[model samples]
Target: MYALVDCNNFYASCERLFRPDLQGRPIVVLSNNDGCVVARSAEAKRLGIKMAVPLFQVQEQIDRENIAVFSSNYALYGDISARVMTVLEQQAPAIEVYSIDEAFLDLNGLETNFPLVEYGLQLKQRVYQYTGIHVSVGIAPTKTLAKLANHAAKQYPATRGVVDLSDPLRQRRLLGLLPVQEVWGVGRRLSRRLNQQGVSSALALADCDAAWIRSHYSVTLERTVRELNGQPCMALEECPPPRQQILCSRSFARRITEYRDMRSAIAQYCSRAAEKLRQQGGLARVVTVFIRTNPHSQLETFYSHSASRMLSIPSADSRLLSATAHALLQSIWKPGFRYMKAGIMLSDLYPSGSFQPTLFDAPESPAAMRLMQAVDNINRSGRGQVRFASEMLSSGWQMQRNRLSPAYTTRWDQLPVVRA
Candidate 1:
């Protein structure tokens, strides 16, 4: 059996973890730069606050309905996720960290001995005890069914945050009731296509011929069908490989007009991206920088642009890539436009140590490696931030409009104090 364990309204739950006073209240978490609603609590959802609704558009609703809003506190969320995963790892034989707030646990051998449903309740209780975040666990013979079961667990309070769809008849009946688009890997386009073909339910899609699906729809659809039919095509991966591309981009809380400010923002993003690349043992050959104006602004002269600069040599080094990124920004940035968002993307990645050394640009030296280690260690220990140029601080190139909660689990200073 495969079990999918997902946190209940993760960001909102994280906010609730420390501030138990906000229990059962309407709450929503904003995206980067407090732009839009990225996460909503059940109470907030009950008020019909749609996900991704612009913060400005919902400001009236918030004020009128007395909705609580919070900034995305990733530090707290990550720490809570770590605690949840750690507790789950101890309980399950093997656990796959699927996302920030989701995981898959293999429950193959416990059907006869320990009941899966009871195990799920225990999982939930343990997770809550460890981190004060409620989670729902769904069990099925296949990953796709497990995902659907998880959704059911989240919606149906009767399940008590645990649902198992391992029975064949139950799986079929459940799929028949669910919309085709709700199936795993089915997006809007594919859902529309399936609807056109008169396949309006997940069961209907699963009943489609695999050959026809492979021909018309994608191989992905076929895989989904197989998974729905209790074939686990995708195996659980314990530690997935690092991402091929690293991006750090955000809309500014306010528009930026000056060239120096834009340059500084781009530099900070590049530096952050480079640090991530190096941490993952990857190097990027292409550096992309982009700046744009807000689309919703009344100002008519709207403009947005991006430029990619090919690196002289693939590098994970912050100093080298950041310099190249600054040069790219110079080409793409246009004066007089009030830019709202700027970002950096490092792509065409390769393993840091496996890069072919070029005659023109040599690889990093031993001394450079040691310096990087020292920088990473100091930053990890919180003595200082990963800094290169003083312009980063001077230009206010940091997370914007952040009204974040304390890092209750991650930071020592921010941890909750227990009364003696």
Candidate 2:
């Protein structure tokens, strides 16, 4: 059997973990720069606050309902996700971290006289007790079927946030009710196409001939069809794949026309991207920089451009990447336009120590490597003091996070308070 464990309202739950006062409030976490609604609590959903709705569009309801708003804090959310994944790693013999908010657990080998449903409940309780984050568990025979079970768990209150599809009758009934689009790997376009072909529900698609489906679509959809029929084609990946590309980007709180600010933003982006690269132990040969004026703003001239540069040799050194990104930014940057966002992209990544060095290009110095490693370590400890000279002293382009809670877990000063 397989189990899909997913955190419920992950971003909002993370926010609420710190602020208990927001337990029953209409909480909505915004996207980069507090621009749009990304995650909303169940209460917020009742208010018809759709995901990706701009804050300005919902400001009236936000003020009227006293909605608790927050800007996206990737740092805090990332830390919380790590904590949750740690708990899962401790419990599950094998786990595939499907996303920051979800994972797949292999439950085949465990000898439990207790019911699997009871075991799933226990796993859920342990995660909640340890991290104070609520998660739903769905157990099934296949990965795709496990996803449907998870969906049912979320949709029906009777499931109590846990569903088991080991029963054939339950599996059949659930598949009959589930729309094709709701099935894993079936998007809107594919669902519409399937609907045209009389494949309306998951049951219908599962009943379709696998060879016929393979002829029409690809092997992946065929596999999904089989998986929906209680066959497990996709195996749980115990280790997630290394990211093929690293991108660091964010929208500024306010539009700026200054080239210096753009330079600073690009450098910061490159620095952060380099940090991720080193964490993954990968080196990049291609660096791309891009900037754009807000297309949604009628007052600003719409301009967007991107420039890419190939490094003479692949490197993960922050200073070198920052310099390359800055030069690329300068080439694409234009004056008299209000720039809303800028980003850095590193691609063609190779393993850090095994990559071939270019003939004419110099490899990173031993001292530079040691310095960056130490810098990463210091920053990991919550002291973000090590930064490039070209980088701004403060994030002038920082997102608007007026309602953000403190870094309760990561920062010493922001640790939770408890009464004895």
Candidate 3:
């Protein structure tokens, strides 16, 4: 058996963790710069505050309903998520971290001794008692069906936050009730096509011939069909696959109009992206930079553009990536438009030691490697004290996290104090 564990309203729960006063109240967590609604509590959802709606549009509702709002405090959320995962890591034999707030755990042999439902409840309660965050557990024979079971656990309160699809009869009954779009790997477009073909329910799609699915749709869809039919097509991936591409992007706290400000933002993003490449021991042959005005804003003139360049040799050096990214920015940036967001993408990556060196390319030097290591260690221990001179010095174009909570777990100064 495979089990999927998912946090309930993760971001909102993170916000509520420190502020127990806001419990059972309408609370929301905003995107970068407090722009749009990224997370909402059950109370906030009852008020009909739709996801991705701009903060300005919901001001009246917020005021009338006395809703509490918070900016995205990623530092706090990440620390909390790590703690939750640590608890699961201690309990499960093998696990795959699917996302920031979700994971898949292996439960094949353990179920032979105890009931699966009891194990799910134990996992759920242990997580809550340890991290103070509620989670739902779903168990099934396959990862895809486990995902479906998790959906059922969250959707229906009658399940009491745990669902087991190990039984074939329950699988057929539940899949019949769920729409085709709700099935794992069936996106909007594919679901629409399936609906048109009279496969409007998960059971209908599961009943389709495997060969016909492979011929008409894809091998991936055929696997999904098999999974829904109680066949284990997907296995528990204990480790994440290596990323082919790495992207770092964020909306600015304020609009930037000057070339120097845009230069700083691009360099910071590239430097961050390069650090990631080095962490993975990978080198990128291509670097791309993009900038754009806020589409939600009603500007006199709106514009968005991007530029990419292939390097002569694959490299993960921060200085080299930052220089190339700044040059790309100069080529695409327009003077008059106020740019609200920017990003850097590194692709065409190869393992650090596997790439062949070109005749004219500079070989990797020990001095350079040592310097990069020192920089990474210093920055990891102490935040951003050692960086390229080209990177931003002041708070010029950082994200606006005005209502951010303190990093209670990670930062020493921000740690909560107990008073007698």
Candidate 4:
């Protein structure tokens, strides 16, 4: 058996974890630079604040309706996600951290001894007790059905955050009612095609001929069908290898027209990417820097620009990557255009200490390697920031004015008060 565990209204829930007063209020979390609505609380959804609605388009509604809005704080979200995964690992036999707000657990051994429905609710209650974040759980014989059951648990309040699809009648009733697009692997185009074929629900698609699906929609669709029918086509994979590419990008809170600000932004992005690379035990041979004007603004002259540079050595060192990224920024930064976003992309990644030095390239010297390690250690210990030459700007390119709630769980100064 498999179990799917998903956080409810993840970003909004993370915000609520700190600001308990905001509970039951209409809150929406914005995407980068407060561009659009990314996540909303149940109250916000009730107010017709649709996901991805631009802030400008909804400004009047937000103000009139008294909608509480927040900028995305990934630092806080990442910390909370780590905590959630830690709790799950302690409780589940095996867990696959699927995303920032979802995981899959192997519940095969426990199913025979315990009632699956009861077990799912116990997991939810324990998670809530530990994290103060609500979660929904679904247990089924296969991953696809587990995913479907999870959707059902999230949708219908009667389930009370737990759903099991092991019963044949329950599985059939749920599948018959689920929309085509609600299936695990079905996308917009596939849903339209499925509807055209009169297979408008999950049960109808699952009953379709496997050969026709394989011939028309490819082998992947066939596998999804088989998985829906209690065969596990996808195995639970944990601790996959580090990524081949890492990208760090964000739109500015306000458009930047100054060269120095652009430089600072690109440098900061590269510094962040390098930190992630080191954390993943990977080094990059190339860094690509890009800057652009807002694509959505009519008054803004459209400008999308990027440049890539080869590193002297494949390195996860922040200083080296920041230097290269700044050089590329100098070549691309324009004076008059109000730049919307800047970013860094690291590619041709390999595990650190595994790559051989190229004949034409100079390897990182012993002194430089030691300095990098020292910087990383200092930053990790929170003694100071690990910064590079390009990040030496006094304060330009800092995340635009953040009126954020305190980091109640992650920061000492921001801890909540409790009565003894």
- Compare the candidates by TM-score and give the number of the best one: 2
Query: What would the per-residue lDDT of candidate 3 be over residues 99-191, giving only the tens digit for each residue?
Result: 999999999798889999999999999999999999999999999999999999999999989999999999999999999999988999999
Q: Write the per-residue lDDT of candidate 4 for residues 53-93, one digit (tens) a residue.
A: 88899999989988888888877888888888898998778
Better of 2 and 4 by lDDT: 2
Candidate 3 root-mean-square deviation in Å: 2.1
- Preferred candidate (lDDT higher): 1 or 2: 2
**Residue 259, candidate 3: alpha-carbon lDDT:** 86
**Regions more than 4 Å wrong, model 1:** 295-300, 359-361, 390-393, 396-398, 418-420
Q: Please give the TM-score that candidate 1 achieves against the real structure.
A: 0.93
TM-score of each: 0.93, 0.95, 0.94, 0.92
Give the alpha carbon lDDT tens digit for every residue of 1-420 in model 2: 899999999999999987878989989999876778999999999889999999999999999999999887787899999989999999878999999999999988663666777888888899999999999988999999999999998899888889999887899999999889999999999999999999999999999999999999999999998998899999999977889999988889888778888888788889999999999988899999989988888876799999999887788889889888878887887788988888889999998777767687677677988888999999888866688877874466777788778888888888989879
Q: Over the stretch 1-420, how does candidate 1's per-residue lDDT look in tens digits? A: 999999989999889877767988899999887889999999999999999999999999999988889999987888788888999999878989999999999998988888889999998999998888889999999888999999989878999999988788989988888999999899999899889999999999889888899999788889899999888888888878889899999877667888878878887787778778878888789988888888887855889888898876787777778788888888887888888888999999998777787788867776766777677777777445668772464555456656688877766777798778
Q: What is the alpha-carbon lDDT of model 1 when measured against the actual structure?
A: 0.86
- Going through the candidates in the order shown, the clash numbers are 0, 0, 0, 0
